[model samples]
Target: MRVPRFCCFLLLAIAASAYADSEIPFAAFELADSTDFTTNAEKNLWLLAEAAATAGDTAGNTQRASLDLRWEASLNRQWRAGFSDRVDGHFSQDLKQSDSLNTLREAWLSYRLTPQTLFDAGRINTRYGVALGYNPTDFLGRGTVRSASSADPEMLRSNRLGNAMIRVQRFWDRAALSAIWSPKISSKPATSSTSLDWGASNPRNRLLLSGSYRLAENLNPQLLLLQEEQRSPQFGANFSRVLSRQVLVYAEWAGGRQPLAWQEALPRQQWQVRWRNRTAAGVTWTGENQLSLRLEGHYNGLADNSRALAYLSAAAGSGGGQNTTPVVTEWVAPRRAALLQAYWADIFDRYDLNIIWQRDMQRGQNLGFAEVRHHIGPVDLALQWQKVFRLSTHSRVLAQADRRWQLSIGYFF
Candidate 1:
């Protein structure tokens, strides 16, 4: 997964300080008193181990273990390289299955051309978007996952796998531009059981170009243009603003010509003539007590309400059609959509709590989630609970509806 963009500022600051002292700074070194730390040098290797367990009425018990390793080395002033690897071992009592696999999550090489231009290639996580809970304008497929044990946006983002691509970026006084290209990237169908492979299904290579400008002291805007293989061109824009010292606002919109799956004669068919528009807007507030609150509304253009209902009705007929199409599952149009989130940081100065409530305004159904986390030394512990509700038989909300409780722990070295 990609780190947050704010880290770039830290890197820039360090680099500038190093040049001020008449030297180029390496990543694995620190500017501090020799006696400040027991070790004079920073370690180039990092390791983390995590264990997670879940219990639910339907899923009796499930356990998983993961080991993550990262190593980085600076070859020269103009070149740097790093790799991240994860090994996973898991077993599910409900399914009576167990498996283990090792994955090279990310491996990239970076080259600096002057102080304002940079190039990166290899497996890269091209994370883009300005929204918190959801991002419709993230055309690079930032890969969002719904996890039971963690709702922190950062943790949710960390679960995404990177794509193979080459990227070039250039920075100006108050703006930046970037371009990315992936020659051959394949995407697995949401309903497919097989792993995502180049041979499973051939997806077109993709290209993205984006530009950002700082318009004012409190406002920044971005524009994104994307061209994917076998897909129509898409245009998107997003903006972030500081309304006040305690308030912030953000929004995103994307428009393009997309396929209408439900209108097609076959379930797997797509009529590419249809036009789609997706919109999301949200506001955040932080109180004196450090409680963060966010409320957002989203509209998914691909989800056609009448068409979705008609398709579901037909599928309910006597063996009329199987709901095996990814279109049906992926394009679920609810009558109404809204998200409410609240987070309390530094509770008792040691605990953090988060709550999320989702409502299907049209069907009057609800999905509730809560998580509590505690940090102790190099280990972090968390507990999560979720409840799903169904009000209509045809409603797509909570298709895999179930209540669950999960516990997870992580140790870093």
Candidate 2:
């Protein structure tokens, strides 16, 4: 994974502080503190720049720079507004070109209708799920970026694009309810003809109604109902519990008519609930040695090994292009059926190490990743390495078949 150099430093800082004897992780505490009613409106600016080289015949080198500005204002005792904008510049060797993009990341207004009721509208980033690496219940999935050339997981996570939405929420002593509606926006720009066809044709317009309850002091459970424009509704639920001061366990499951592939020759329905169960369970451990360990297991019933092999074979026989069936080209084996992750922070109070191993049990493939970060004031230096191996597949056919490494230094101001 490409590590966004600056985010590595931020994670290191948070993890270092997480060893404190607190029931919740540092991230949770930070979020809670940010929403305090007494806090004054303020503006902040963040700047980032980094350069790296990859071992490839083409596009071996790249450079990136970005500036982010965020502001919040309290319109009144009950109304608040937030704005965020980012400007990014990139240069890549293979493209032999440089490009820049200006993005309006978030622009939202929030109102506290009452002490226990809240409403939010406008472009917003909506995130759900308690899992760290992957969130099956996060229906929106992480927003897409303009480019996929960078490997920093943190950067990718933070650079989420917003969707137009309206939400209402009410909180009780031990429970809460939320209703959300997100409209579908045209993915591509309208042509000169002003046809405006794609916007109405998209099927992503949807609604979500969810409820959460604190059954006890340590157990929190949530339920979600998702309604799409032209598809059947889906259901999801998740829970997290504090086993002890240093341990936490969480599970998430979602059921829906997920899309699947059929044989190229046999005309098959594009979307079917062949495997409707997607579930994940995991536990995390934190200790005073500035160490954290997480083990997770994910099961995706839709990933049929036989189907995947057949799809791959068909795609190969069809020359792996548009000639291949759309479903065959789109279907992929679940990548994270099993995962083990470890983190060590404040190594000498200035360095951190993170390691992860993941396996696609059905595909018989595994991946290993390691990254080390060193902090120097506002600058972060990092080195990352990744390797992929296939146990029962063709020796030469692997995504991470070759070893890859990258070194980058990022400055934040």
Count of clashing residue pairs in every prediction: 0, 4
Candidate 2: C-alpha RMSD after superposition: 6.6
Candidate 1 local lDDT, 125-225, one digit each (tens):
45565555556787754332312234344444444445677889999988989898877655542322224333212245888898988787656688999
Residue 28 CA displacement from its true place in model 1, Å:
28
Candidate 2's displacement at residue 213, Å, is 0.9
Tens digits of per-residue lDDT for model 2, 182-247: 877774422222232233222268898989888897676889998887666879998877787677
TM-score of each: 0.77, 0.76
- Which candidate number would show the highest lDDT if scored against the true structure? 1
Q: After superposition, how far is residue 339 of candidate 1 from its true place, in Å?
A: 1.2
**Per-residue error (Å), model 2, residue 202:** 8.3
What is the lDDT, from 0 to 100, of the residue 170 in candidate 2?
97
Worst ten-residue run, lDDT, model 2?
32-41
